[model samples]
Target: MTAVGDARIRRAVRAREEGSDLPGVWSAYGGLLQHLRIRAGLSQQQLGDAIGYSLELVASVERGRRPAKAAFTAAADRVLEAGGVLRVLQDEVDRAKLPRFFRNVALLEAEALSRFSYDPLLVPGLLQTETYAHALLGAHFPPLDEEIVEQRVAARLARQALLTRKKPPVVFVFIVEEGALRRFVGSDAVMHQQLEHLVTCARMRNVELQVMPAVRSVHSGLNGPMVLLESMDRRRHVYVDAQGVVSVRSDEDEVSEFWLRYGMLRTQALSTEESSRLIERMAGEL
Candidate 1:
C-alpha cells in the first residue's frame, strides 16, 4: 500500500474524490494495471520487485499519480500474463503526453504516404535529434515530471523510424524558417548535433529540406505552421496547431487551400542545395 503521507498518493485520492477528469485516460489505464496486478495475486511490492522498481513507484502508477512508461508497462504485461492487453496501451500512453489535440495528428502522420510541413518555430519533431528533443520537452511550461519528459522524448524519437521504414514515404518536404535554425534550442553542443542531423536528413533521396529566409519580402507562412498530409489511400488532410489547440481539416476545400499555401511557401523558400549550404554554415558557427 502507498504511504498515506505521500504527496502523490494524497493528490490522487483528492482528485478521485473531486471527480476530476484530469488525466482521464491515464487514470483508466492505471485502473486496468491495478486490476491485472490483483488478478495475478501480486502485491505492489511483489510487482515492484519483479519489475525492478520501488513499491512506491508502483503504487504511484497504479493510482494515476505517475505515468506508466513503455518499458515498465511491457514488463508488467509479461509478468502479469496480460496477453498484450497492457502492451497495446503503450502507444496510447505515449500519445497522452502530447498536447491532447495533437494526438490525432500523430496517428495521421504515422499512416501518411507523403508529408509536407512548414515550421516557423523550433525544429519539426520528425527532424529533431534526441538531445534537441529532450531540451525542448524539458522546457515546457509548468514543468513536466522527469518520467513524462523522458517518455515524450522517446515517443518523438520513435516517430523518426517511419522515415527509415522498408517502404518509406514517397515524399517528405520540410520548409523551416531561417530563424528556427539560428535560434539555439538546448546548448551549443545540442544545436550542433541537431544541425548535423538535419544536414544528413537533407541528403535522403525522398526528402526535400528548404529554408524560408528571414529577409523574404513576401512570406505566405506568416499565418503560422501547418502540415499537409496525404494518407495511404490518397486522401488529403491539413493540420494546424496554435496556442495548444490543434485543428485537423479533412475538407477538400480547406485541404486544397493549405496545399496551395504550402506550394507558394516552398517556392518562396531557398532551394534544397541552398538550404543545405545554410544549414552547414549555421552548424559551423556552433
Candidate 2:
C-alpha cells in the first residue's frame, strides 16, 4: 500500500470528524472514474503511475475523499481512453470544492450572460492574482484547513474563465469602493500585484471595472454588496453574500430592485478609464 502523507491523512480525518456535507458531485465523479479504471483492467497503482500521480492521491479521488484537480482529470481521461467524459465534469467538480454557501450562486454566475456587482470591501474574486488569493484565504477566520484553502483558491481561479468565455459572450461590470482597494488585504506587495491585475482585467473587452470613491459616504451601494446577473435563460437574478451566508433569488420584484441599485452604483462610481488610472497609481505607491 502506498503510504498516506501525514498532511493528507490529517485533513481527511478532520473532515470526517467534522461531518461536513460534501457535494454529491465528488462521489459521482469518483465512482465514474473507478468504473472506467476497472473496465480498463488497471489497478489503482498502475493508473496512478501512468498518470504521474501518487497512488494515495488516486485512491483518495476514487473514494471521494478528495476532489480531483483539472490536470488530474485530464490525464486520467487521456489514459483511460474515456473520450473526454471526465473532462465534462471538471467545472462542476471544481464548483463543488467551493464553500458550500457559495456553490449554487457560483454555478449560476458561471452561466450568466451578464454580471454586474458592487463590492464595498475587497476586490472581487475574478480579479484576484494567485498571491492575493493565497493571502486572503490563508487569513480566513476559524482557519480553513490547508487542503481546504488550496481547493478554494483553485476553484476561484477556475471560475475566472467565465470572463473570457466566447461562446456565450458574457459581459461583466465590477464596482469596488475606493476605500476597499486602499485597505490592505495581505500585504503591500500582494495588493500591488492585485491592483496591477485589476488593470489587466479592466482591459478585457467584456469587463468594465469602476471604482467608488471613498469620499462618497452615502450611495445606493452603501447598503452592502449585491450581484445582478442575467442567467442563460435571460432571467435576471440577485445574489447577496455576507459573512459566508449566501442569498440568491430570481423573483422579478426583488431582483428588479437590485438591478436598479446596481445601475445607480455604476453611475456613481468613477468611469472605467479613471478607475484604471487610479488602480495604476495605487500599485505604484505599494
The best candidate by TM-score is 2
Model 1 misses residue 185 by how many Å? 2.4
TM-score of each: 0.85, 0.90
Residue ranges of candidate 1 with Cα displaced over 4 Å: 1-22, 142-148, 167-170
Task: Assess candidate 2 and give its lDDT.
Answer: 0.86
**Which lDDT tens digits does candidate 2 get at residues 1-286?**
0133234334544554367576666766777788788878999999999999999999989877799988999999999999898898788888988888898898888889999988888889988888888899999998989999999899889889898899989999999999889979888888888998999999999999999988778889877888888988998999898888788988889988888878888888899999999999989998
| C-alpha lDDT of residue 70 in model 2 | 87
lDDT of each: 0.84, 0.86
Q: For model 1, where is the 10-residue window of minimal lDDT?
A: 1-10
Candidate 2 Cα deviation (angstroms), residue 279: 1.5
